[model samples]
Target: MASTTDTKNYKFNHSMIRVKDPKASIKFYEHLGMSLLKKLPFPDAKFDLYFLGYDAPQSVSHGKEIWDREGLVELTHNYGSEADPNYKVNNGNRDPDRGFGHTCISVDNLQAACQRIEDAGYKFQKKLSDGRMKQIAFVLDPDEYWVEVIGQKSVEETEGVTTTDPATYRMNHTMIRVKDAEKSLKFYQEVMGMSLYRTNENEKAGFNLYFLGYPGEKGVPQGYQADREGILELTWNYGTEKDEKFSYYDGNSKDSEGRQGFGHICISVDNIEAACKRFEESGVTWKKKLTDGRMKNIAFVLDPDGYWIEVVQNERFSGKPNF
Candidate 1:
């Protein structure tokens, strides 16, 4: 029997979002402690790209850092006559809401993190992470997309834990658009047992937002204890019909069938059998189950909303207690 922490195959790369202003967005993350990594300018493409992370320089002895570099968040600014497939470009129409999709980061101090962000002259949409005794703040880039920050030390400060690793990128949190924020909130909180950290009905902004997570976990798993960087972002357009299929350009689309949209999310567990059993006991259904196949010992499950999620007993990092 494997425990939830036994699955070590779980990993989150980065959540990609479309931004109208790249430089401003870059400054937003920089304010949260992320450094500018590599910036790629597509001269032929009229788009500027930037990558930011909180890791030290690479070592000479090791070829390339595997699971030991700083966590990273990528931002791309596209300049052109591009149109959001789902949204019509009308001058009369207002801008999309700030919650369309957002990213969250872990910081050293919850209050300090929020203060720092507020000090930067940015408008915060949500309070610091306090509901769960963690510092979490929500602010938006110039494009109106929200980015959250959580105190990294909280997880590390837990009873006993130390998050140290260059590759240990704390990739936590995932938010997506739903037909009804209330319904989605209830689904996660009531069904999944996640505590509703915070939510907003920003009619003035043309949308609503909600953030939920495991209510009492000292910190999310992977690295840095609790004081890590990043969160999952979700965006749901208000008073809009659920599209049969949406787009997945990291812009404004959630096409389930198309290549674009919120892809499946993964959760690592120590014991795949027990984790799957817990979900089954809780009434969650499986989309794919572990079996003899290409990715052995892996299974997929779906939330009530039809979004896919992966549950696995990561066999790679089998040495750690909650890896």
Candidate 2:
């Protein structure tokens, strides 16, 4: 289990993905009700970071630093990546590299939300009417990353609503494929100290989903799963764990045969040193230590599937400068 001391303070913060054009990416997310919270530029590093997120429940600040909120999306634009004609980022959804599936946004009116995206000239991976599952629709971003649009209610009830407004929209979850269900469950449950709130299985489709997150008191009743935040959805395809030749791309590593487009998910901790010490004794794999690179305040640890989970704190260790 995660160290009981600081684990309670650790919360899922944001998921990062690389984009070719920050302008186009920002426009896309803005259309989906996300506000650009702040932009961090690293001129020396030749890159910029754009943090976007929806307003947290009862939040007074319409705009605040994204790192202060939970469940934000970080769009990384490396300088001149847009100008490179030969640069092709693997979206991590194609053949032999199918690992990260999609990030979800729950809407009160699924039909209206899908119509808005389609009418905006954006591409759709799966329409509401597409496939056996008509309840959820998949829209593609500029990078062709899937953004799943799910409904707040059952399909029949959702479609019956006449209002065109998707009144409540929240960044629900980010889905990733894992090899072993049991092992993955153990890691997220015990090690990360997240609660497995719900599970869904498709017996004929040969897969199961486990939704894990930290629960809190929103003004609204937390009875619905859609109301919660910072959820991690793990997809376990039956038999992949036993297959000796099968593995998903870590998404941040260049060592994989496929190029990486998706980055890491971040979790905020109270004290970086205490968190690192507990993780070390637990034998968690380290992608980058707190002091390994130029960024001394953050660390990266690998999950069982090699996906990087970034560990960070809001302020410096000395508490002089607050981020």
By lDDT, who's the top model here? 2
Residue 230 C-alpha lDDT in model 1:
28
- Single out the weakest 10-residue window by summed lDDT for candidate 2: 314-323
Count of clashes in candidate 2: 0
Q: lDDT by residue for model 2 over 1-323, one digit each (tens)?
A: 22234565556788899898899999998888787887889999899998887874543223444444577889999999888776556677888777788888887788877888888899999998888899888999988999988887778886766554533577888899999999889988777767788889999989999998755334322456775568899999999999988899877766345367889888876677788887888889899998797788789998999899988764423344434
lDDT of 1 by residue, 119-226 (tens): 678887676543653445677655555566555555345323332332322444556556555656665555444455555567776876655544223343343334
Q: Once model 1 is optimally superposed onto the true structure by TM-score, how far is the C-alpha of residue 11 displaced, in angstroms?
A: 3.2
User: Which candidate ranks first by TM-score, i.e. highest?
Assistant: 2
How does each model score on lDDT? Answer: 0.49, 0.78
**Model 1 misplaced regions, further than 4 Å:** 1-10, 56-71, 80-100, 129-135, 153-171, 177-225, 228-250, 253-323
TM-score for each prediction? 0.46, 0.90
